[model samples]
Target: MRRNVRVAAYAVCVRDGRILLARWTGAGGPRRWTLPGGGMEHGEDPYGTVVREVEEETGYQVEPVALLGVESARRVIPRRGWRRSAVDHQAVRVMYEVRITGGELRSEVDGSTDLAAWHKLSSVGLLTRVPYVDTALRLWRDRPPTGRAMGSP
Candidate 1:
């Protein structure tokens, strides 16, 4: 198996009992709601990555107010065809608490996310979403000193 590691940044923007989210339309799979952020460019700072991604995905200018935590996970991606090897994929994700500074809400244009919207906190669990959404929210709510949720291994 080949090993692939990805580093990405995500924002947890909660306001008025709602959270800002973007609908991911990548990987040619089913769409899922996720935080408004993405992978960093070469030599780009994670701070810049989050700001740029938020704007691109949700048309919002955001200022990261605090470092929420990091979530690292490893998974195996089955090979798509006979010639390719199964991938050992690792994701090192950085989460941040951000506040919207400016810009009107709008969907991204021909990007990974097709729609951007704010959803009621209570309604989040009713919608289809990526697991990271819950993870990030937990980090935001707990704000553990170790940057991980309480009792999380």
Candidate 2:
């Protein structure tokens, strides 16, 4: 059995009690609201990836303010559709909380997302945010772990 893994970066751009989100139009024709970010390029830092992705997708410059958290999803893929084969796939994503530094909001003409907007924090749960968005929000809402050094004597 072979497994495929994908690493992606996402940003939770929050401002004035709202969070920036993008509407992702998938190949399957389903649209989903997601945090502003995307996959990391080869040899690119995760933080940089988030900044570039946010700018590219939302046309806003963002600076990562905090390291939120990481999430992973694993799924089995059929080698063939019903009559075909099977495969294994896993997707790992790192999410961060970012603050807008500059630039105005504009959608990229050639992008996976069709729209970008800020949604009220209180209404986030009511919308169709991607799974990682919720995870990132939870991490942001909760303070990071605090303790002594791992190997302190």
Candidate 3:
């Protein structure tokens, strides 16, 4: 198996009972809804990566308010697109709560995300979303004071 490691930052931006999300367009088949952030570039700080990703994916300026948690996971992805072999991908994800500061809302063209919009927090289930969205929302609402992540037994 081909092993790959990725480090990414994600934002949970909520306002007026709605949450901002970007439709992720990866080499995989279908698009999945996720927070407005993505992988950090070489030697890039996580904070700067989140800000840059949020702006690139969803034309909006944001300030990360608090660091929510970190998530590490491994998944198997089938060979597709340019990938000649299946990949065992390990991702270290940093979750953050962010506040929108400025800029207009617009979808990214010719990028990993083609659409960006707000979804009603109560109705997020209607959209196809990545697992991180669920985890981030749970973390945001639970606000575990100890700063420890919860896991299923």
Candidate 4:
């Protein structure tokens, strides 16, 4: 079986009891909320990648405070899009707790995500979110030792 590993970074920015999120519009699925970040480019620093992706997706400037955790998932996806064959995908996701230092909320143009907003943490349950959202929140709250990153590229 063909296989590929996709590594990405995400931010959990919480301030004043609200969490910052970007609305991800899928190709065939309903719009769902997700953390503000994306895949790291080749030769790109993860820190720089997170900064750029968050800005691109949410229009907000963020500073990564601490690494919340790492989440990984694997699944079989028909790889006709990248023009690759049927394959397995392993996503190693880096999660961080970030601080929103600046910028206004705006919609990302011609991107996978469109809207960016701050929702009450308590009310986040009512909104449809990607699974990683819950995982990030739990890692942020639990603060387990195993969740801490030693040093990630």
Which prediction has the highest lDDT against the true structure?
1
Which pairs, if any, clash in model 4? none
**TM-score of candidate 3 on Cα atoms, chains taken together:** 0.90
The superposed Cα distance between candidate 2 and the true structure at residue 78, in angstroms, equals 3.2
Clashes of each: 0, 4, 0, 0
lDDT of 4 by residue, 44-147 (tens): 87788888899898888889999888988888978576656888999888988888789888979999898999999999999999978888888888887899
- Per-model root-mean-square deviation over C-alphas: 1.0, 5.0, 2.3, 3.9
lDDT per residue (tens digit) for residues 51-138 in model 3: 9999998999999999988878888988867648998999998889999999999999999999999999999988898888888897
How do these models rank on lDDT, best leading? 1, 3, 4, 2
Q: TM-score ranking from best to worst?
A: 1, 3, 4, 2
Candidate 4 runs further than 4 Å off:
79-84, 148-153
Off by over 4 Å in 2: 79-84, 146-153
Root mean square deviation (Cα) for candidate 4: 3.9
lDDT of 1 by residue, 1-153 (tens): 899999999999999999999999979899999999999889999999999999999999999999999998899999887799999999888999999999999999999999999999999999899988999989998898888866455
lDDT score of model 4?
A: 0.87
Tens-place lDDT per residue, model 2, 17-65, is: 9989999987666788998888888899999999999999899998998
Candidate 1 deviant stretches above 4 angstroms? none
In terms of TM-score, which candidate is stronger, 2 or 3? Answer: 3
lDDT of each: 0.94, 0.81, 0.90, 0.87
Residue pairs with backbone overlap in model 3: none
